[model samples]
Target: MTVSLHTRRRQSGVTLLGLLMWAIVLGFGALIVMKVVPTIIEYSTISKAVNKIAAEGLSTVPEIRAAFDRQKDIDYGITSITSRDLDITKENDKVVIRFAYNKEVELFSPVFLLIKYQGTSRTTTR
Candidate 1:
């Protein structure tokens, strides 16, 4: 009996079509990250602002809203929500400020991405 090594060389590596599909997928992922990062950053800024107001011992709704407005003016990243949009209330003798907003990012002509952000202040007056 003799051994034969002339079998089909076998198919290896990615084809052009496979590479293109991968590229498209990766490209879309990158685009999504690009659009989402700034929004996340802005949300973080807003959260900090809320916490600051809560910590500053602002006892009234107007005062808390005013503080947020000032913070918003200082931070350019904050745009989706405003002081007037915040929901301020008293709970258990503590001041609570809550806010929620939606951001729409236009990816293409008719395609838009919507991001919902909601947060509450950490500072609650006792």
Candidate 2:
């Protein structure tokens, strides 16, 4: 059977429409991911900073407080920094450092969702 050129062209017309729809869907998806990834990275940065301080082998409340306090801008891309309720106490006979923080992320249109990345970290005394 011989395929007609007209039929082939008709098939391409639908393909182009599908391609355009897909491109738009993917574009928005990329935008959402772009907004999300940075927020996640910021939270991860907070965790790393906390862990780094804990690794320093400081067992005092003042020392732990200093560690977190000193790292004000651990991540350059972090847009918002908020300190949550933190309690540095001893648990299981080990020093426990628990802190939570909130980070905000901004993105382009579609109501411009304001995402918050909240994270908690804890460390036991050495």
Candidate 3:
């Protein structure tokens, strides 16, 4: 009598197509993040400017705008929205300065991304 042995083989791995697909997805995500990072930095700068304006007791719209302009002049990153676009309001007699703007970034042909940013002072000076 003779004994016989049988061996089975299985294949498991990512194909070329799968690798390309993953690369595409990650590439798109990286592109979006690249565009978003600068926007986030600008927003942070704007927030700091707003907080500074409020802390300095700049209640009037003109005063706040001028303050922001000065800040923008000092820091070039705050260029998206100007003083004219600011929304100054009063809540319970406390001055509130708010601003909103949109940034358009093109990823590829006919593909664009819209980023909206808005912020207000943390606390009123008065």
Candidate 4:
């Protein structure tokens, strides 16, 4: 004749603390992507310029450097390295242009990210 009591199940969901933590993590990730994408694009531009100059059959170092400088002027993305920083070499009678540079990006106060970029041109036979 006694009435039975129904047991209540505990609710399961993300708490306020958990949601805040996830928001912080996602915000930090987005910040990093925003900062790093431009540098990657710049690297791609520099690589294309080097490959184009190498395939142009420029025999002299000065000519190659000047070509890169011109390309840099045209494509405003090249700032990490300059014409003087390039390592020009000849291999098997083909012009090889090599470049290496470092980019520093500031994520927050007292914290910095360093990225090293290097590339060698893909030369073509005339």
* Each candidate: RMSD: 2.3, 4.2, 2.6, 2.2
lDDT of each: 0.87, 0.64, 0.85, 0.92
Question: How many angstroms is residue 105 displaced in model 3 relative to the true structure, after the best TM-score fit?
Answer: 0.7
For candidate 2, lDDT tens digit of each residue in 12-85?
Answer: 34577899999999998898898778778766776777667666777777777767766755556534453334
TM-score of candidate 2 relative to the true fold = 0.65
What TM-score does structure 4 among the candidates reach? 0.92
lDDT of 1 at 26: 99
Give the distance in Å from residue 46's predicted Cα in candidate 2 to where it truly belongs: 0.6
Instruction: Give the residue spans of candidate 1 off by over 4 A.
Output: 1-6, 123-125
TM-score against truth, every candidate? 0.90, 0.65, 0.87, 0.92
For lDDT, candidate 3 versus 4, the one ahead is 4
lDDT for position 35 in model 3: 77
In candidate 1, residue 120 scores what lDDT?
85
Q: Compose the digit string of candidate 1's lDDT tens values, residues 1-126.
A: 655677647779999999999999999999999988999999999999988888888888889889999999998889888899999987888778898999998887799999889998775556
Residue-by-residue lDDT tens digits, candidate 3, 17-126: 99999999999899899978998998999989888887787767888888889988999998798989988888877778888999888878798888888888776647
Candidate 2 deviant stretches above 4 angstroms:
1-14, 73-79, 82-85, 102-104, 109-125
lDDT at 65, model 4: 91
Question: Candidate order by TM-score, highest to lowest?
Answer: 4, 1, 3, 2
Tell how far residue 74 is off in model 2, in angstroms. Answer: 5.7
lDDT of 1: 0.87
